[model samples]
Target: QISEATDAPEAFVAKILQPLSKKGILISNKGKQGGFTVDLDKIEHIKIIEIILATDGEEIFTRCAFGLEKCSSEKPCPFHFTYKPIREGLKSSLSEISIYDMALKTEQGEAFLKI
Candidate 1:
């Protein structure tokens, strides 16, 4: 259902689900009634940062926006300083946003999962 709704291949969704499940962000069942679900009790404590890190890893927070091999403060790339603050800001925002907040936004039509 998620794959179809997102227009992503089942394999792609499966790959994403594996990491999330391993990280305890998702609960997966493997039977006729099998499906993945989030623990509603814990959902309010699950920040966007946790979901992103579980699925995408730390590279998104560490890698260069311009794809420079060794971009860093010591030997900065062209956009290093400029991108640093933006990345940090995004990280901070994600850390503060819970899945519940996003769900509320989606439910209230203030945000969306697609488009």
Candidate 2:
């Protein structure tokens, strides 16, 4: 259902969900009627950053915005300083945003996962 709604391939979705399940962000059951389920009690504590890290890996937070092989304070890219603060702010916001909060906004029509 989620794969259909997201318009993603089932295999792709399963690959992504596996990491989340292993990270304890989601629970997966294996059986004829098995599917992934989230623990409602922990949903409010699940930050967006957790999901990003689980599926996308740490590279999202560490990779150079300009696709440079080596970008750092010692040898910064042209867009590094300009993009650094924005990247930091985005990470901060994702850390503070919970899945519950996102659902609430979606329910209120304030946000949409797909448009």
lDDT of 2 by residue, 1-115 (tens): 7788678889998999999999999999999999799999999999999999998877777678989989997899998888888888888999999999998998899987676
Which candidate gets the maximum TM-score versus the true structure?
Answer: 2
Flag regions of model 2 displaced more than 4 Å. none
Off by over 4 Å in 1: none
Compared with the true structure, what per-residue lDDT tens digits does model 1 show for residues 12-113?
A: 888888888898999999999887899999999999999899988888888998898888999999899999999999999999999999989988999876
Candidate 1 whole-model C-alpha lDDT, 0 to 1:
0.90
**Candidate 2 local accuracy as lDDT?**
0.90
Q: Provide the overall lDDT of each model, using Cα atoms, as 2-decimal numbers.
A: 0.90, 0.90
Score residue 106 of candidate 1 by CA lDDT. 86
TM-score of each: 0.89, 0.92
